[model samples]
Target: MNGGPRLFSILRQGPYLIASIHTALDDSQLVRFQQDLVERIGSDRARGVVIDVAALDVLDSFASRTLRDIGEMARLRGAVTVIVGIQPDVAFAMVELGMDTGRVVTALDLEEGLAELDTYAAAPPAPRR
Candidate 1:
């Protein structure tokens, strides 16, 4: 169980699920969030997931890695994860600290995040070679 306030909130939006994280997540909260996220993705059959981290005051190395890990785990369960709402300072800090969320797409805000998912959904399947 998370010792602090809930680390994240998951909301279902059409075929996509939006997970918005609260500020200042410790290691335990991150683990719990991942487990709960996996359960939600499977139960909801989410085609895409948007992680809104706009609320966080800062994005440290641990949180950055955890977000990427969560995205990868969701991907394994058949969801394309997009991380959105990274503050300007956080982005600068992430670069300075050498932190990267590998392979996780991102957007400027929630609206753009939803649009990204919708665009992907609207695309026709690639024709077989």
Candidate 2:
């Protein structure tokens, strides 16, 4: 993707990739966003993907589904995905609209999201003695 105006920003934070959406995205930007995320994940090989959507006030069905899809794709690429920063209104709207995020995990904020992702990335607990 061109380095033009980006709808979102992706930063490599340790073993996790944090993608924060800064604005309301149109359909085209959404597509570009997906492509960019895929490229970033592929190149970085991050252990987890944390998407911070605190700035986004509106979470439409399309956007929600796209995020879910992205999370699934990230997992396929060997990285767990955690979506954080969901607004109260957006959460209510999503529930009222019956928009499901499938298996995508969610957290209250970036810190919590990263914590959850770490759990996913960490090695499993040892067997019982």
Candidate 3:
């Protein structure tokens, strides 16, 4: 279980679920968030997910992996995942670490994330590889 109250909020907007992380979460909390998010994606029948990590000053490897896994899990449930609001420092560190972004897409902010989803929706579907 998470160590305390939820550290983030997930709200569904239309076909997208937005998860805003306003603070750093412990390992357990991060895992819980990932699980809860994936479950919510299925339950809500979301077509896309936006994870905003603007408030987090650091992005450790574990967190990066968890984000990637969340995207992959959501994809398996027929949803796209976009990560928005990555601070410049965190983005630099992620680049320096050669972090693999995997299935998640990145955007400048929530607006752009939602726009990305909109574009995805308007585009023709891709054939599965």
* Top candidate by TM-score: 3
lDDT of each: 0.87, 0.88, 0.91
Worst 10 residues of 1 by lDDT: 1-10
In model 2, which regions exceed 4 Å deviation? 1-6, 125-129
Model 3 TM-score on a 0 to 1 scale: 0.93
Model 2 per-residue lDDT tens digits across residues 32-107: 8888887899899788999888999999988998999899889778788999999999999999999977999999
What TM-score, to 2 decimals, does candidate 2 have? 0.90
Instruction: Report the Cα lDDT for residue 66, model 2.
Output: 92
* Candidate 3: stretches off by over 4 Å: 1-5
Q: Write the per-residue lDDT of candidate 1 for residues 1-129, one digit (tens) a residue.
A: 358566679999989999989776788888787888878999999999999999987988888898899889987887888999999999998999899889989999999999988887788755666
lDDT of 3: 0.91
Error of 1 at 22 (Å): 2.3
Candidates sorted by lDDT, descending order?
3, 2, 1
TM-score of each: 0.89, 0.90, 0.93
Worst 10 residues of 3 by lDDT: 1-10
